[model samples]
Target: MELADRVQSLTPSSTLAITSKAKALKDEGHDVIGLGAGEPDFNTPSYILDAAKEAMDHGQTKYTPSGGLVPLKNAIRGKFERDQNLSYTNSEIIVTTGAKHALYTLFQVLLNRGDEVIVPVPYWVSYPEQIKLAEGQPVYVKASEENSFKITPEQLEDSITSYTKAVIINSPSNPTGVLYTKEELQALGEVALKNNIFIVSDEIYEKLIYGQQSHQSIATISDDLKDITIIINGVSKSHAMTGWRIGYAAGNENIIKAMTNLASHATSNPTSIAQYAAIAAYSHDENEIEQMKLAFEERLNKLYNWITSIPNVSCVKPDGAFYLFPNFKNVVNHSSFDSVDEWVKQLLEEEKVAVVPGSGFGSEDNIRLSYATSLDNLEEAAKRIKRFVEKHSK
Candidate 1:
């Protein structure tokens, strides 16, 4: 039998593929430094682990409500209020399996056949795919590197049509690590409001910012903007709970209800013990988050400098997240590679340093190198990348 048409349209994730390949190489005893991972390298904090243990000891391991544990929802509600002074009732919240799933569920519920979601270029690799899986059309809006990889309000307005249902905004965006300033978001939010398009704000990397960069939630711009915005976030990145698989979406009551209903048939619920741990994650002090952020900032600074030092490599200094997306078009041209993907593969094979090509993120000329690993690994990886560039330079 033929597979479903949607299955045929789907593209397997390139980020995970590269990371998996690097792991296989390492397992074969090859010295491999994989920079394709999107999670924090830190372990979940002791408080959160203790909470999970307590929940299990208290027999809280059973399934939760299809939405999530009531306490976890309350904690998530409190988090938004604390972080952005943004209020979201439990009815407007749905804890999900992960931030990725939150986006998936949001699209599933929000889109219908031929509905369009405007995705900025250099997006998280999954945005377009998730939209497509929801039977929605993904209209790509290129956010050029010259513009600091941010889509202008004019670009957003130009992309919208009657079929446009929503536009995704990933502040401290993955791959590029660029943060949208408050002013920039205000402009975009105004356009979104004017165009009557939902704003899917992915703030998964909110807590992992670098020097002088603050996270701005488009929802917090105004009550109107807040009403039309869906915030996707989770403990995976912020609390280093990637293994725990806890995330959430907060927005309009109707949309949240729809997402909760879909999640019931889909995931049943997020893990109950993980929900308990997330309560601790949200209620606790910010100490653990600070330390992780500092580590990433250090690595980002060092790696950014190291990678940019290579001949013909140029990078935009990012304000948030743990990635350095360097434009290697010049390097690729100088090194005689036909494409960025070819250069990435050659670097991995010849130098055993695996970095994700930017092709998957909608920028064919750039590549994303994650610094979410140890200083030693990152430093060595940078050295390998530099050497690879030098060796391949014509």
Candidate 2:
């Protein structure tokens, strides 16, 4: 049987592909150090797990409201007010299975056939595919490395078109780990307001920042922007609850209601137990979250220095998130490999260090290595990468 055109046109996620390849190699008895993982390696904090247990013991196994439970919504609302200085009513929030699901649902509800969503370069891999799945086009604005992998207001203005419906802003971005400053977001918000388009702010990595860098929600810039912005976030990265699949979106009540309706037919509610766990995640003391951030910061500092110390590799120090995206153009140019993909393949095969090639994230000159694992694993991976670059350097 023939697949739908949408399925045929979709590209498999290269991040998952590389990760699976690494797992296969490990299963074959090779000591593979897989660094492509997007989730934190840490376990869910005990308090959140305890909450799940309590919910289960109370027979909270049935389906909830299609959007989310009232308690979970209240917790999410409180989180936004406390962290972002933004307030939302229960009608304005819809909790989906994950942030990714929230995004997919948003596209399905917000876009019409041939609508365009502006996506910046070095974006999270799923953004473009999710837009396309909604019969929308993804217009990419190249965020050059010199700009710290961020697009400017002028670039945003240039990318908008008659068909443009939304612009995605993934701060503390995946793959690149770059955060947008508050002022930067304000300027971009102006462009969105001027163009009468929506701003889809993916703040899933909001709590993962290091040092003085801060995560700012674009929706908090002003009432106008908030009216047009959809805030996508969850407990996946923040609370190390990737498997729990509790993510939510806050925005116009109409859109949230539509998304909830769509989800009602698709997956019903998010897992009942997971919703209860997320309530605890949002309500509990944040000490565990801070500890996780400190651990990642330490790993990032060591691994960033180690990678930059190598001969032919260069990377911008990430402000947040757990990944290091380092440019390997020099290494690729000097080696027998014709592309970053080939270089990544050979490195995984020979050195047993798995990394997602930058081509998958809309840039072909770099590769992403996550520091979410232990420092020992990062150190070992760095050693292997350093050797690989040295052997291939011109």
Candidate 3:
């Protein structure tokens, strides 16, 4: 059997691959401490679960509008108003199976053959693949560790071309946990506006911020930017509802309509019960989310200090999200290993610790460690990593 050229050319996710390998080792009775999982460690709040139960008991198991249920859309609208001070009508919102699906649909609707989408380095694993699936070229702009793994306005301006259709900005970014400041976003928004290009703002980690850092939507900078920005978000990360499949996109009504129409033939709608549950998630108190965020903050602080204390390992202290991207370039050079990949493999095989290599995120000098686990697990993983580095160092 033959696969499509596009499918054949796609790169499998390194995060998922490392996670699977860790799980396999665990199944084989190895005590593997895996730091590759991206979702929150908390369970979905009971109120949200109760809402789903009520929906099922009240017969909401049937299909909803392809775009989403009106109530859910209204809840999302309310969230935007309360959180970001941005308002969107129901027509501008379309809920999909997940934030990932919302993004894939956006690329499908927005891209034409050979169109370019400017993706920053150390991007979420799925962005480039989704662009390729939509027949769009991914133009990568490298964001150095010195810049907190964020692209400058100059870099953004330089990467634009006639074929550039959109630029993705992921704040509280997945692998790096780097948050772009409001001023930074304003500058980038200006670049996109001047170029007449679209901004795909993936704010799925918006609610997962820590310290004094805040998540700012590029769309909120101005009316002009809002008109051209598509905000991709969901309750998956915020409410520990990763399994709920209730992500949505908010932006231009025409683009939302096109994405909805595409979704109508594809997923039809996000799961009915999950949509109802998400309504409760958005409409209710956020105490649960606050608790989870605090827990993550605590774990992150400890893990950050621990990792940086290790010899020759340095990382930008993450401002938000539950991951720490630590550069091991010095360690790699001092160790017997030739590359970060081999170093990561040996750590997993010998110390029984699993982490995603930075090469997957377009950085070869670092590795991503997700603190979205128990503090105990994180501590143990750190110990194992420290020991491994000590043993291999020349």
State the weakest 10-residue window (summed lDDT) of model 3: 211-220
lDDT of 1 by residue, 242-300 (tens): 99999999999999999999999999999999999999999999998998888988898
| Number of the candidate with higher lDDT, 1 or 3 | 3
Total clashes in model 2, counting residue pairs 3 or more apart in sequence or in different chains: 1
lDDT, candidate 3, residue 129? 98
Taking all chains together, the TM-score of candidate 2 against the true structure is: 0.99
Q: lDDT of candidate 1? A: 0.92
Off by over 4 Å in 3: none
lDDT (Cα, tens digit) per residue for candidate 3, span 340-381? 999999899999999999999989999999998998999999
Better of 1 and 2 by lDDT: 2
Give a tens-digit lDDT track for model 2, residues 107-196: 999999999999999989999999999999999999999999999999999999999999999988998999999899999999999999
Q: Each prediction's Cα RMSD?
A: 0.8, 0.7, 0.7
Stretches of candidate 2 exceeding 4 Å from the true structure:
none
